[model samples]
Structure formats: structure tokens, C-alpha cells
Target: MNVLVTGGAGYIGAHVVRVLAQHGHTPIILDDLRSASYERIGDFQHEHVALEDTSKVMAVFQKYQPEAIVHLAGSISVRESVQTPEKYWANNLGAGMSLLLACARFPVRIFLFSSSAAVYGNAVETPIRENAILEPTSPYGSSKLAFEHTLHRSAQALGMCSIALRYFNAAGAHTAWGVGEQHDSEEHLIPKVIRALLTAQPVQVYGNDYPTPDGTCIRDYIHVVDLAEAHVLTLENEYLGNQHNFNVGTGEGYSVLEIISAIATRLSVTPQITFLSRRPGDPPRLIADPSALLSHVGWKPVHSSLQEIVNSAVEWELVRC
Candidate 1:
């Protein structure tokens, strides 16, 4: 199968591309290289073009004639989205609409979107399911939710199948391949902590007085490899519904303090700490109820342990340093 992965040169997308390759599928990468590094994608068939450029996107679709498209391109940072909403709307929602328009022209069978738990906002429920209330607090979340809605409606109209994986806190790395999180402006928690420890800087802990057990925000962290594998499973499952939406997570929650402790234990080094108020739009806790995904695809997260997750991240951090 010919698979086209947008943002294939990115952290999670690169891992997904590699996994698709391992599964005997040829992946043609489409990345703008704005936020991603070309070194990560290596020698994969890459097309350096932005999603907003319809001409370029249409050209790639015409050339590759991909059976499936895993769309991962967009503005991802919640904080950044808040600061620059026009940029977010232009990139996330606008680019999504453009891509869909292009895809509709040269109709691809499958489209796997990289959605987020941020769509759920501050959920009233502990483990958020796909049917939960969606009240996104940030522009980034709203953009993703809007894209999902568009994809859902368009898929039905165009006879295209789509899956939007609402994932949370993608951590860790592919240990065997030496590929891991390598974002430039590194906003995620794990990477920030790793860099802090490496540079002997303070590990800034936001909101140490939350209602959680550790007085900090709690999140459902899933390994990037496991997350990538779920994409592959979505492709293989021909019996999947017309438009499937799954929460790609371990159905487990870990506190910010717990994650820091796990990384500290793995590296055998104490991290410098500094507690502060919670950032705007950050929920107290966001955990996933992956029962629907598990029951549907028999998908079980292999690296559910916090120690293992932190260990993989630490190993990659060492190599990166």
C-alpha cells in the first residue's frame, strides 16, 4: 500500500512512517520542514510542501496516488495557539480544509488524523471516552476538533473512510531505531524535564496544588511506538466503521510529580524543582477511557509502565545530548 504521511519528518509522524515501512508498506512523506528536521525522516520519499499550498498537495496526491493518508500536519501548541489564534486557524483549520479538498479531487480511501485529548477540555469524567463532552479551552484543541468534524462530514459525503485518534501525552521513543521526540521549541513535559536535567536547570513544575494525589496535573501518557502501532492497526482493520474515532491511550493516569520521579529514577539524578501556578487552558487531569478502542481492535498498550516510559525517554535524551 502507498501511504502518504503529512508531517512525516516530525517526531511522532516519523515513528509512524518507520512502523508503516516495517509492515511492508511504502510511505511517501509530505513535510514542510518548518517545525520538523529532515535528518529525522532520512531517505524516505519526501515532498517538502506546506498543507496550505493546494497546488503542491494536489501534485503529491497525483504523483503518489496513495491508498491512505495519515494527516499529522498542524499547529500543535496550545499556548502558542492562544497567543496567535490567526496562525492556528490558518494552519490547522485552513490547511485541513485545503488538504481535504485536494484529497477529494484524487480520492484516497483512508485518512488517519492526529487528534488530541485537549478536545475534551476539563472533562467532568475521569477517564474521557470518545462520546464525552467536547469543550476545548484552547484554540489548538478547537482547531483539531473542527478538523475532525470536517473530516467526519466529508468522509460520509465523499465515500472516504477516516479515523481520528484522540491521543494524549505522546511520550518515549523507539529504542531500537534511535528515533524519538526532537521538536525544536520543545513544549511537552518530558522533553522539558530531560533538557532541564541535562543543562542543570530547574525543572519547572506548574500548579503544585491541584486536586490530584500529588497536587499536580495528571495525564494519560502513551508511548510513541504504541501510538504509531495503533495507526497501522487502523489501516489493517477493513471492518472498521465508516468514520472511527478512538482514544489512543493506556487508560491510566500519572501525576506530573510521578513522571518527574520516574525520569529521575531512571537517570539516577535528582532534578532541580520549581513549582508555579497552572498555565492557562491546562486542565487538572485528563485521562482516556480506551475501552472502545481496546474492544474494537483488541489494542493493548504494551509499554504502560511509567518507569519504562521514562526510561525510554531518558535513553533518547542521553543520545541527543
Candidate 2:
């Protein structure tokens, strides 16, 4: 499969590109290197094209004529989105619109979206379902959800098959492939803790006084490799029709303190931790049902255990250092 991977140079996109290559598919990367690091892209065949650049995007499409498009390009920061909403709206929604329009006009058939769990911000329930109310609190999440809605309508209009895989915490690295998480500004917990722990710095635990048993906020951490596998399965499946949505998670929740403890145990170091006030718009607990993905998509998480996740991240961080 000749696939056009938007944001194929970034953290998650790199992992997905690696997975696609391992699965015997050619990934023609399209990344502007705006927030992406070139060192992380390694030897993947890619083009310097922004998502909103229709001419450049069309040129890449003409070159590859990709059978599928794994759309991973976008601005992805809840806090940053809150601070600069116009940036989020432009990059996330606007760039996505460009690709969707191209697909509608071009020969591209399949579109796999990298959606977010932030779409269900401050959920009313613990284990969020596919049918759960989508009340995104931040512009980032809203932008992703808005693109999904457009994807549905555009798929019907273009006669293309689209799937939006709503990801939870996509942590860890491709330990075997040696391509792991590498961000210009580290925000995800696993990498942040790994960097801090290695440097003998204290990691701040935000608001450990929540209602949960550990009093810290709980989140569903999905291994990057597992997420890549889900994309491979869904994208390769020949039964996709108009549109589909799946919440990609392990159906497990780990609190902030638990993650710290796991990192401490895995790395054999006493982590220096500091508790701070909770960041607003953060849910106390957010787990996934994930039943729809298994039954419908024939997929389930195989590398999402907390110990394995922490271990992979620690290994990648150690190797990079």
C-alpha cells in the first residue's frame, strides 16, 4: 500500500510510519517540519509539505497516488490550544480540511485520522464509550472532533472510507524498531518523567488530591506500538464503508502517582516528586470501554500494560541520552 502520511516526521506519525514500513507498506511522508524534529524522521522517504498547502499536498499526492492516507498532522496541545486558539483552529481544523478536500477530488480512498480522547473532556462517566457525549473543553479537542464531523460528511460526499481512531495517552516508544517518542517541547507524562528522572530532577504531580483512591488523576496510557498496530489493522481491512470511529485505549486507567511509582520501580530510582494544583479542564478519571474496537474492528491492545509502557519509555529515553 502506498500511503501518504501527513505529519510523518513527528512522534506518533514516525511510529506509525515505522509500523507501516514493518508491515510491508510504503509511507510517503508529508511533513512541514514545523514542530517536528528532522533527526527523528531518520531515513523515511518524505516531502516537505504543509497540510494547508494545497499545491504541495497535491504534488505529493500526484507523486505517490497513495492508496490510503494516515492523517497524523496537526497541533496537539491542550494548554497551548487554550492559550492560542487561532493556531489550533488553523492547523488542526484548517489543515485537515485541505486534505479532506483533496481526497474528495483525488483518487484517495481510505483516510485514517488520529483523533484524541480530549474530545470527551471532563466526561460524565468513568469508562467513556464511543456513544458518550463529546463535550471537548479545549480548542484542540474541539478541532479534532470538528474534523471528524467533516470527515463523515465528506466521506459520504466523496464516496471514501474514513476511520477516526480516538487515542488516549499515546506514550512509550517502538523499542524494537528504536523509533520512540521525541518531541521538541515534551508535554506527555512518560517522556517528561523519563527526562526529569535521568537528570535527577523532581517531576511535578498535578493535584494529587482528587477524588480517586490515589487522589491523583487517572488516564488511559496506550503504547505507541499498539496504536500503530490498530492503524494497520483498520486501514488494511477491506470492509470499511463510509465512516467508522473507535476509541483506541487499553481499557485501563493509571493515576499520576501510580505512573510515578511504576517509573521509579522500572528505573530502580527514587523519583523526586512534587504535588501541585490540578490543571483546569483535566478530568479526574478517563478510562475507555474499547469494546467497540474489539468487536467491530477486530482489534485489542496487546502492549498497553503499565509496566511494559514505562519500561519501553525508560529504555528509549536511556538510549537517546
Candidate 3:
């Protein structure tokens, strides 16, 4: 399958591209290089084209004529989205519109979206299900959900099968493949902890007084390799018609303190910590019930163990240092 992967140079996208290649699928990268790191891209065959450039996007379709599109391009910072929603609305929704229009006009079959678990904001339930309520508190999540509706409409009317994988805390790296998480301003917990370890700095533990076993906020952390494999399995499935949603996770929750301890143990060091007040909208526990993915696409997380995730991330960070 000749697959067009938008944002193919990104942290998750890079892993997805390699996984697709490993499965004998041709992944044609289409990244604007705005937020993507060239080092992570390696030697994959790619085109420097933005989705907002309709002419170039159409040209890409005409050139490769991809059978499927793994749409991963977007601005994905919740904090920044709160400060400037127009940017999210423009890039995530607006540019997404341009791509959807192109998909409608093209002969593309499978449209796999890289959606986030942030769409379910501050849920009152643990192990969130697919049928969980849709109430995104941030503009980032809103943009992703809004685009999902448009994709659903396109699937119903245009006859293209779309699947939205609501990812929960995509961490770790595919260091063996020479691609890992590298953001300009690090936000994810694992990478932040790794950086603190390398620099011998104190990692701020927010809301250590939460109602949990360790008195810290808990979240589901899925390895990037497992997350990428989930994408390939869904794309390869023959299920047709309608837009489907699945939670891509290990269905296990790890508290923030637990994650910090895991990384520190992996690196053989004692972590410096400072407990602080919880951030607004910080949930006590947020985990995914990924049974839907297993039943529908025969997908199950294989490399999402906390130790392996920490080791992979630590190896990649060590290389960077």
C-alpha cells in the first residue's frame, strides 16, 4: 500500500512511517518541516509540502496516488492552544479542511486520523470507554473532535472509510530505527523527566495530594512503537463504511510519581522531586479501555510496558546528550 503520511517527520509520525515500512507498505512522507525535526526523518522518501497548499497536496496525490492517508499533521500543544486558539483552529481545523477536501476529490480509500485522548476532558470515569462523553476542555481537543465530525461526514457521503484512534499519552521512542520524541519545548512527562535526569535538575511533581494510591495524578502511557503498530493494523483491516473510534492504550494507568520512579530506576539514579499544587483540569486517574481495538482490528499493545517505555526513551535521550 502506498500510504501518504502527513507530518511524517514528527515524533509519532516518524515511528509510524518506520512501522509501515517494516510491514512492507510504502510510506510517502508529506511534512511541512515547521515543527518536524530533520534528524528524526532519517532517509525516508518525503515531499516538503503543507496540507494547506491545496495545489501541492493535489499534486502529491497525482504523483503517488496513495491508497491511504495517515493524517498526523497539526499543532498539538494544549497550553499554547489555550493562549492562542486561532493557531489551532487554523492549522488543526483549517488545514485539516484543505486535506479533507482533497480526500473527497481523490480516490483515497482508508483515512486514518491521529486523534488524541484529550478529546475526553476531565472525565469522571476511570478506564474511559469509546462511548465515553465528548467534552473537550481545550481548543486543541476541540479542533481534533471538530475535524473528526467532518471526516465522519466525508465517510458517510463520499464513501471513504475513516478511523480515529484516540491516543493516550504517546511516549517513548523507536531508537533502534533512529527516530524518537524531540519537541522544541518538551511537554510530555517521560521526556521531561529524562531531561531532568541528564541535567540533575529537580522534576516538579504537581498535585501529589491527589486521591490515588501514590497521591499523584495517574495517566495511561502507551509506547510509540505499539501506537504505530495499532495504526498499521487498523489501516490493513478490510472493515468498511462509517467512521470508527478506538482508544489506543495499554488499558493500564500509572501515576506521575510512579512514572518518575520508573525512569529514575531505569537510569539507575534517585530522582529529585518538588511537590506542587495540581494544575487546573488535572484528573486524578485517566486510563483507556482498549477492548474495542482488540475486538475490531485484532490490535493489542505488545511493547507498552512501563520499563520498556522508559528504557527506550532513556536510550534515545542518552544519544541526544
Candidate 4:
């Protein structure tokens, strides 16, 4: 089966591309190389075109004739989205609409989206489910949720099947593939904490007055490898549906202080920290109830342990330095 993965050169996208190849599938990458580095993808078949370039995107669809599409392209920063909402709407929802239009013209069977847990903003419950109310506080989450609706409607109208994996907090790395979470502007907690520790910089901890135990934000973190594997399993199932939203995470929640402590323990370094007010659009706790994914496809987190997550990230940071 030939699969077309947008943003395939990105952190999680690269891992998905590798996993797909290991499963005996042809993985073709479609990336703009704007926020992603081309070196990450190596020699895999790819097209250096943005989704907004409908002509080129259609050309790639015509050329590869992919049976499945794993859409991972778009803006993904919550804080930035809060600052500049137009960018999020244009890239996340706008460019995605173009891809959906192009997919309708092809024989695409399965469409897998990279959604986020932010959709369920400040959930009243601890472990969030797919059926939870979606009241995204940030433009980033709103954009993702809006595109999900578009995908669902488009899939049903065009007789296509789609799955949106609402990822909680994706951490760790796949250094074996020479790729890890190397964002141009790092915002994810794990990498930021590790970088601060390595350089002896004071890492800022947001919101120490939340309703949590330590008064810090809590989240469900999933390793990139495990997250990529879930995408492969979704394709294997070839689920027949308009759009199925699954929480791709471990059923455990970790606080910000807890995560820092775990990373510090693994790297054997004392982290310098500075507590600050909470950033807007950030939920106090965003833990996922991933039972739906497990029951649906027998998927499990094999390499998502906290120790493994921290160790892999530390190794990647060390190698990167």
C-alpha cells in the first residue's frame, strides 16, 4: 500500500514514515520544508510542495496514487496561536481544506489526521474521552477541531474513511532514525526542560497556582515512536468510518514538576527553575483516556514508559549538542 504523509520530515512525521516503511509500505512524503528540515527524511520519496500549492499537491496525488494519507502538516503552537490567530486559521484549517479537496479527486481510502488533546479545553474530567465536550481555548486547538469537522464531512460526502488521533503531549525521540523533537522554536516541556538543564539556564515553569497537587499543569505524554505506531495500526485496521477520533496517549498523567524531576534524575543534573503565571489557552490538566484506541485496535504503549521517554530525550539532546 502506498501512503502519502504530509509533514513527513517533521519530528513525529519522520517516525511515522519510518514505521510505515518497516511495515512493507511505500511512504511518500509531501512537505514544504518551512518548519521541518529535509535532512530528517533522508532519501525517502517526497515532494517539496506546500498543501496550499493545490496544483503540485494534485500532481503528487496523481503521481503516487496513494491509497492512504496521514495529514500532519500545519501550525502547531498554542501560545503562538494565541498571539497570532490568523496564522493558525490560514495554515491549519486553510491548507488542510486544500488537501481534503485534492483527496476527493483521488482514490484515497484512509485519511489519518494529527489532531490534539487541546480540543477538550480544561476538561472537567481527569482522563478525557473522545466524547468529551470540545471547548478549545486556543486558536490552535480550535483550528484542529474545525479541520476535524471538515474532514469528517468531506469523508462522508466523498465516501472516504478518516481517523483523527487526538494526541495529548508527544515527547521523547527516535534517535535511531537520526530524528527527534527539534523544533525551530522549542515550546514542548520535555525538550525545554532538558535544554535548560544542559545549559544551566533557568527554565520557566508556568502556573504554579493551578488546582493540581503541585499547583502546576499536568498532561499525558506519549513517546513519538508509540504515537507513530498508532498511525500504522490505524491503517492496518482500514477502519470504515467517516471520522473516528482516538486519544493517542497513555492513560497516565504527569505534572510539570514531576516531568522535570524525572528528567533531572535520568540526566543526573539539578534543574534551575523559575515559576511564572500560566500562559493563556493552556489547560491545567489534559490527560487522555486511551482505552478507545486499545479496545479498537489492540494498540498498547510499549516504549512510552516515563524512564524510557526521559532517557531517549536526554540522549537525543546530548547527541544534538
By TM-score, the candidates rank as: 4, 1, 3, 2
List the candidate 1 regions with Cα displacement exceeding 4 Å.
none
Report how far off residue 89 is in candidate 2 (Å): 0.2
Put down candidate 1 lDDT per residue, 1-321, tens digits, no spaces.
Answer: 999999898889989999999999999999999997768777789999999889999999999999899999888889999999989889888887767888789988889999999899999898898999999999999999998999999989889998999989999997678689988788999988978877788899989888898899999999998899999888877888889889999889998888887777767789889998889888999999998888887788897578778888888888864
Candidate 2 lDDT over 171-284, as tens digits, reads: 888766767887778788888887888888999988988999989999999999889889988888887666888999989999988898889888788998988898988889
Q: What's the lDDT for residue 226 in model 4?
A: 95
In angstroms, give how far residue 147 of model 3 lies from its true place. 0.8
Q: Which parts of model 4 are misplaced by more than 4 Å? A: none
Query: For residues 150-247, could you state the per-residue lDDT of candidate 4 as single tens digits?
Result: 99999888888888999988999888778899998999999999999888888799989999999999899999999999999889895434669999
1 or 2, greater by lDDT: 1
- Give the winner by lDDT: 4
**RMSD in Å for all candidates:** 1.1, 1.2, 1.1, 1.0
User: What 10-residue stretch in candidate 2 is worst by lDDT?
Assistant: 100-109
In order, candidate lDDTs are 0.88, 0.87, 0.89, 0.91
TM-score between model 3 and native = 0.97
Model 1 lDDT-worst window of ten: 260-269
Better of 1 and 2 by TM-score: 1
Writing each residue's lDDT as its tens digit, candidate 3 over 1-321 gives 999999999999999999999999999999989997677667788999988899899888889989999999999898889999999989988897767778777778889998989899888787899889989889999999998888888777878888998999999887778888898788889999989987899998889888899899899999999999999998999864357999999889999989999988887889989989887666788899999999999998988999889999999998764
Clashing pairs in 2: none
Residue 50's lDDT within candidate 2 is: 83
Clashing pairs for model 1 are: none
Query: Higher lDDT: candidate 2 or 4?
Result: 4
* Clashes by residue pair, model 3: none
